[model samples]
Target chain A: MSTDSNPITTEAEEKKEEVYEAEHVHKVYDIIAPHFSATRYKPWPIVERFLREMPAGSVGLDVGCGNGKYLGVNPSLFMIGTDRSRGLASIANHEFKHEAHVADALDLPHPPGRFDFAISIAVIHHFSSPERRVQAVRSILATLRTDKENPGRALIYVWALEQKNSRRGWDENSPQDVFVPWVLQKGNKSKQPKEKSQKQAKNLVETEVKATASPSGDSAQTRAACEPEEEKKEAEPNPVYNRYYHLYKQGELGADAVEAGGKVIEAGYEKDNHWAIIIPA
Target chain B: MKLLTANFITCSVKSCQSVTPALSFRDAELAREEIDFSPLFLRNILPRIDWPLLQRTAKELGFPALPETKPELSPIAEGDEEGVGSEEEQKLLKELHSLLLETSVQSGKLVCANCGHEYPISQGIANFLLPNHLV
Candidate 1:
């Protein structure tokens, strides 16, 4: 609910942000990983192209590879994926033989300067603080090969705040840090209310509905409009989890990549996400 | 985790960056799953494979000892890009594919050489999320 604009000054503050993200980001994904994975089966074109273009036998890292969707893509390359949420990592491994692990983006397990490439898609934005975001990027970039003749590359994607044409309609004026609600249908196998009591769950959903209906009410209305009529008529309110995201503005991802000791080679807006390809400087 | 994946990963702990021999397996339970063999893929990835590390890992897992030196394969000729190469080369690539791609660590722990941190592996997935103090 709160936005952090000031620079984190102390380790204590940095730890505090980690805790915040653990609550708002990591825990949310753990609870919704299966549902999230179901919706994330498709690989974005740019990401697929990046993987497909890699030379056969090249090894790489998928830093926040949720569901390991991209792991099997271009099987010629050996890609290891890591996710902060164990649930998501488990799904990624179970669904396919691709290697996945539970590891934080800021503290990856891969050896430094070893990978041929790395890709972190829709991952770094979960960091609650700017410093942590840049640190995550730095950690990813550290895993790439820094050879002068064949420098390693990394492709990173983050939700963009400038998606005026998208259904959510966020734009330049929207707050960069916001909580996005993910409505989990009750019948889904993974659906479980965070609150034990039905009354508490109802209260939680009401609060989230009010929050969505307050300023930028279009998202809530649009979601309702798109949902099937049967979903609206359900007796029990579906559990809604709010995930925190720091939507990147134009040029921000490239700037952060550079600040993280990388040179941005390609940067653009794609499908409401800001993506950049960077190599170690 | 694939046996090959172990070659690229080490201790997640920042202080253990200089650790020697990377990570060593402990109580490893391995499984072999069939994967499509591609000679070209093996040939291309051979250079990146840390032969010594791979040898150590293979020995620990009770696999047959690898050759002392890493295998070197000649590049595929232009007209035979899809060919599986000579019989000897084909045999080497298939063995490499079976060892590196098909052989996987089903359950175990990867202990760091320097920090002695134990990263547990279950159902072929490793958990490298360290405790707060280590981070």
Candidate 2:
């Protein structure tokens, strides 16, 4: 009964924590890919402009090209897309009809100078560490075509820690780590009795949310098992899945891009995001 | 995975570009009809195609021979204009178009010449997940 007899050590506990952190991000993306894609159908104007202005027939790369949204902006430019998510990559190739691969942004499959131009939109910020973020940018830079006459360029987008809207901005004093909210929707089941229609169902959902937040005790599976069979058969309530985000302050991304051996051409904020354009140095 | 375009992929290992004839393609799927072939579009794309490397790749892929050297860009006024070039040049363009756009690696492995990394291509999408040592 001695607590000191526990087999787990600090190193093992820390490793487990690290694994959980990584799982949190990857699992969230896997679960939300479809919902995320549906709302992201429109290509951001700046990204559209960047792709459109790329020289005709230049080879382009779209890193983290979820659903291959901007892959075919310029048909003349042969483009390749990649994403860490296998589901997204499959959607890119089969559904969107774009050439895409399932690859990590930090370690791209293509060799140096493979692309005339490259872009990583809203991707680098997902890295757990600052060093990894820089590595991700540099890795993409290496694949860019670096001829002097037509030096290749890269465009990157990261979430901004500070925004014009106060509600969206984070405190400058704290680390730029935060969790943004993602709401998961489960369709309402029609099998519920007619008397328990809308109002009663909403009340039940609210009560269920409180019950799931149990501070006192049982494991999640235990709690689920304890629920009544009839309740288990009912439509599940919507759950908020908080997503981890590493926000960058103004000039932060540009500085990292430069430190990673890129020459920053432009850096600024748009909406709740900070974006930059750089050329490999 | 059309073997003809394998030249574009290189070793994923650090500090190794690897020599040609290093990476080999297998089970290439040629489906160029899926691409919209516009002469104007292809004309602009012609310059970026590494002719020597592409020829070598095509040979490896078991496709018919490409011209010994890269063809000069057709001097027709507008790529879309009729009588854009002579019959010989037009024939070359059509061949180049098929070689570049139509060929894809649907199911295969892209083995790195130097580090021996095997990047698998399944359902026309390459899974380039490298182990921690390589990363």
Candidate 3:
């Protein structure tokens, strides 16, 4: 909303992003900026699921808000995308960051319980130790709790550490850098999807779970993100037209990830293609 | 809540992130009434905003499918499928303000850009003003 004239100008937006500049803001997102695209980088299904779930007009934080790329979101949420990337701050502004800025997810600068829900996508592994990753999640909730009006429990989604050859972005520099998390809803008896990609045809299925995100109740959802390498390897070379997506397996993250952060509501996918988490503001 | 609450801050944080406040899910909806940007304004704005981020936010905030690139000054002249010099394009843009830029979510926090500060919005306004020491 600032008077920004240069589409590529960082100066104008920089004038607005002076606050919350900390280390690690850019490290987690540096590679993701140019190479990332809402349509190209991540699977559309994950975005679809997020939009179906997260509550609208809630005070929420996108932990790893690399380049501020939200997959697909409901048209009703009040959003402030953050990343450690200070460079991305202006980008967030040029894109209408009502108050987007560069901040450290690991060491947040927020009061306890100030935010409604804290969301970190594909950002956990960036930390050297699992303890740090968990701490960062706690910091976010702490900020969420700072608010006097904060309801109670926080809804956190940690991309359990599932790394496959495909989702690696074809960069082998550091396999441990990125971890993806996805899982079924709580207490759902549905058997976990097989590690091997199954082409078994099934009825077009879509399910919606509407659960309010408060200070209490189901909080965290951990599932290894779907890695795209295996599927891409299985695909014939140079085969264009079909979509390529990462399907996370296991080892992405775990119960400890939540405990490391604090008390949280764990949410995972329950049914096949039917996982939705509603985060209250 | 007042309109300037988010922008009007009393903190010393010099960083933009600190000075600004978090945008609550409520602001995205409430900002609709408080903000009144015109397509003409957004025409000037689109180029300034992060295209991908804005596109996603716009869609989330109720704006319809936006073009891939920043809207050109002569957006209609660019021969958008809406047609160059088309009245429809102009009309649609005017509507965009109400949907994306106009909405103000008061009673939340804005992440500051100057000092990475967190400016709270007690009312509708975002307190962005900074204090002396941190500034």
Candidate 4:
């Protein structure tokens, strides 16, 4: 056997490497895909709104769609459960895997404007930085693009189940983990791209943060923070969304993300203690 | 609605901005996706792709693609073996992103090639459109 004979195969094998060495992440929901039927978990009502509201049969990009619990709840919803671990994907394929795919949620592969809705659950907190969480949410929303025909194509993203003291955060009280559902629609296309300056976008972010911080929608601390007459701008004053949805401590993700996106349309949190901020969709 | 080609339209919770990368797909900058032209590009690009997402995307974008098991890189073709650098095997890498990335097929009834669901791509968007009758 000469060295030249097997070079290609050897080189090809280098692309795919096993990750999360301990398999800690993979073990969590490896078995859930099979036993995840709504008949079992009984969390279907929370996820039902998502199914009911969404345009029937729209492609759902499940970020960390563990074992297709949402799929088990509603199999008709064409789901693509994505996970970083192959073990979980294999188990998903065996049981509730409508179409189990092993991939990173952060770097989703579909062309820009792919899915009608994106649902991510109990995943973002795992990252070690506010920037990572921010980037992750932005990446998922990237799937939602403007609709050409509808003029205001709505993109729903329900980022429920945030960890309060996520081990991923820098400090125990870090305000990085908060549910901020995003909806990007059309209609607002008339305004040129340059119309809304970076200043306005920055201000919107600041206002969102202030609203979250002040329970009554306005407060003295927020007033002091908002006033610009004499105050100097803190280069990064609450860049992350600190207010809005209540953050769940660690692991309280009761609802499926796919269903949550669906909820944005129909009931609008009529039941769940959760209500979305309702960004322009 | 908006024609965004190489330029990307990025949005945060508060705003949306369109960006265009400086890199042009010229000979000077052979894209990692140009693996079909040379295997080295495949070797380099594979590491950068969100493998699992890429795999899911492969399935999502009309190909039942799977993420790599690990970060493994190797030569697609041996210039020494063929007595020439064959740009054949890496074609998948070149076309994979083009098949997956550059092309955005907006507005159609996207039927899952596998599951047989009629997902509508309405308004330059694709959503798995199930019916009330199904629900």
Candidate 5:
């Protein structure tokens, strides 16, 4: 991958990555939050079990809790969820009545070493650089409690590169950095793209998809599956917002946790995602 | 955001880490929404609550002043785990539930003591994403 051969080291490169992510990841989620949230009501079984097992009244953080689906899983536990997108955070607060806020993962608003536990599900993969990914993990680990007898833990999950059985067909050999498309079907009054002309939006999506798909052969299939078929009446194409994802290879999630000064208690692949339970070192 | 949630939040800016009572409420609009009362949950969470901070928050939000010291509940006996405690304990737990989980800040600004960065709360959701300079 280009990121491997040309590592992001300079300040300018870091700033560029931030801008890139803002456009590809943050803005895309904001545009698709309602539609995205409609399909995200189900809590993954492992995450539900993890939340249920925590002692009642344990206070925890949910870093990048999109739509706050997991926040209300355990009524006894008090969990404050933060998401980068204001749109998703608002849904979390309004629809779910969960305590959620808009906050970036790297610059969280919580006190360090105070929370009893934290969960970052499918969040860190949005970081465009390896260093930023590790830094994001470090920021999350900082919020956990450090007591020896009952140390706070974090549960993190990221999309796995080795998901051959999945529909996307990404494997270990596929380029880790790629743009995943999110097609916003027309006529969804709430999910319309804001402040962009149709031509401009189409050009932006084409350029991004072309630039990022050179290494991956199945990009077309990915886009085809994302676009819904019910929009045949609309003359213009559905606005496809490409999201950047750094698909993790096997063991990388645990490695990132260790690099961020955490000890991996348990790690495994579950349903095309790599998840780990980690604690402060 | 709940009155209870404010105790856990601090200024997002890195330099404001040492500021005591990390955030203060400004023009907060309060609402009382009834939720299920759970005494066992309150007993379990009491150890983690910052009494002084909670007191300060309660005062700022114009609620009745909290007790100077954190309340202590007797240990749960083997068979009485699910039973609500004696009348006194039940009263305390109900008060706490009304204050912490039921009373929510519907809209306001959370001002940092050190940096003076105001995180606006709208529709009961606080926006803690800082500007580029702070990041």
Candidate 6:
């Protein structure tokens, strides 16, 4: 809610704005749960590698674990995944059979030093302010099980304001605070024969494909291959869910973790995502 | 919905860790167990386990046999190396594994000791979302 025109002023006011923004972000996810989960099937290789390397039966926590994609990386590890969206949590529990709970990222349910390892993927960027993003990271830090022998580590990923394959402009003056759109399927049926509607729907789907073409040829190929035989038949106005995001600049995430009393072990970029490995201080 | 792990849950109302501290499970239902019992896994997990909290949780759940102090990890187990263990160690491992992995609270409410905020576990998933006023 802290727009460019009316900038946030007082600390208390900023905090209040952040709470409203957080609620809005959660609402967006709650609305787009199905659409979001459909496209988020693959696990990022970096996250999979981290989970795979963990000791067997070691307890791990996944904050904002959307669809629980990385929760079942290793069967031996006891992973507890949490997300704000109940729909996504139910999908994770019922479809994937993963252990997940409906919980907030900032105010987590667990105590201090509760988990041996933790992760928050594509989560922090959703916060409207840098301070709330840092607070979210601190929440993860509070749950880490750091001790002498076992120094708990966490991996966090945020969408970078600077992206290589950004179709959307990544100008220096580009607002880090912006709304990204998620186009949903048109639900209402038209007054036409079933076969003709299917053909028209196919044409609309093709038009959609052309309009939203990505820079990557791989995506184009995948989309083209998966097009036919699908029921894209509805003829209705596509709903666009505009979700808020505060994309982090390079080094921004690492600095925030450090500010939250965490030591950055490694910091680097993976595609449009900037990630860091940190041990809670 | 299946119970994952109640080992890490705590009362956040005023940072309360007092008497009746940290919500305890009572008359709960155990629903799911995905991981197989391994003596090595249990031994490796010993140090990470919050002994006092788990013991308190177990007592509240109507299983009062967990020792006051954590049992020593047998040297012969070589759990970190993923080595199998002897029969004697397996018996001990079974007991620990049952307490940690097997027993899961499917449905219950977690009442805070100090402020008395009831965190309900429905559909095998606990809702830990506190209201704005509470925060």
The TM-score values for the models, in the order shown, are 0.87, 0.79, 0.41, 0.35, 0.87, 0.79
lDDT of 2 by residue, A30-140 (tens): 676665554455688889889999877688789999878898777867788888887777777787778878777866767687688888998877775666778888998
The Cα local distance difference test for each model comes to: 0.82, 0.68, 0.40, 0.37, 0.83, 0.71
Candidate 5's C-alpha runs over 4 A off are A1-9, A187-236, B77-83
The digit string of per-residue lDDT tens for model 6 on A3-100 reads 56655555556566555565457777787676567556668999999999998868889999988989888876778899988888877876777888
Candidate 2 lDDT by residue in tens digits, B1-135: 333235456555655554554565655554545555566666776776667777767886787887898778757766546434776767766676677777776777777666777888888888877775675
Report the lDDT of model 3 for residue B44: 42
Can you list the residue pairs that collide in candidate 1?
B1-B124
Tell me model 2's lDDT, rounded to 2 decimals.
Answer: 0.68
lDDT of 4 by residue, A1-281 (tens): 65665655522332111122112233333322232221122343545566546653355566665545554455333445656544445454444324444445555534455455555654554443333445555556556644544311222233323323332222335453332311111122212234344334323332322222222233443322233211244443322212233333332222222322311233232222233211113
lDDT of 1 by residue, A191-213 (tens): 33343443343333322211212
Instruction: Point out the worst 10-residue segment of candidate 5 chain A by lDDT.
Output: A208-217
Which residue runs of candidate 4 sit more than 4 Å off their true CA positions? Answer: A1-40, A148-281, B1-135
Stretches of candidate 3 off by over 4 Å are A1-28, A37-48, A96-99, A145-252, A261-264, A269-281, B1-135
Kindly report which residue pairs in candidate 5 clash with one another. Answer: none
Docking class of 1: medium
What tens digits encode model 5's per-residue C-alpha lDDT throughout A1-281? 34555565576677777887897789999998887776566689989999999988899999999999999999889899999999999888887889999999998998888998999999999998888999999999999999888899999999998988765677888778777776775454333344444434333332323124212235464342344343475688777777888889999988899999999998889999999999999
Q: TM-score for model 3?
A: 0.41
Write down the C-alpha DockQ for each prediction.
0.72, 0.59, 0.04, 0.02, 0.72, 0.46
Candidate 4 similarity to native, TM-score: 0.35
Per-residue lDDT of A223 in model 4: 29
Model 6, docking class: acceptable
Q: Give the fraction of native contacts in model 4.
A: 0.00
User: Which predicted model would earn the best lDDT?
Assistant: 5
Model 5 whole-model lDDT (C-alpha atoms): 0.83
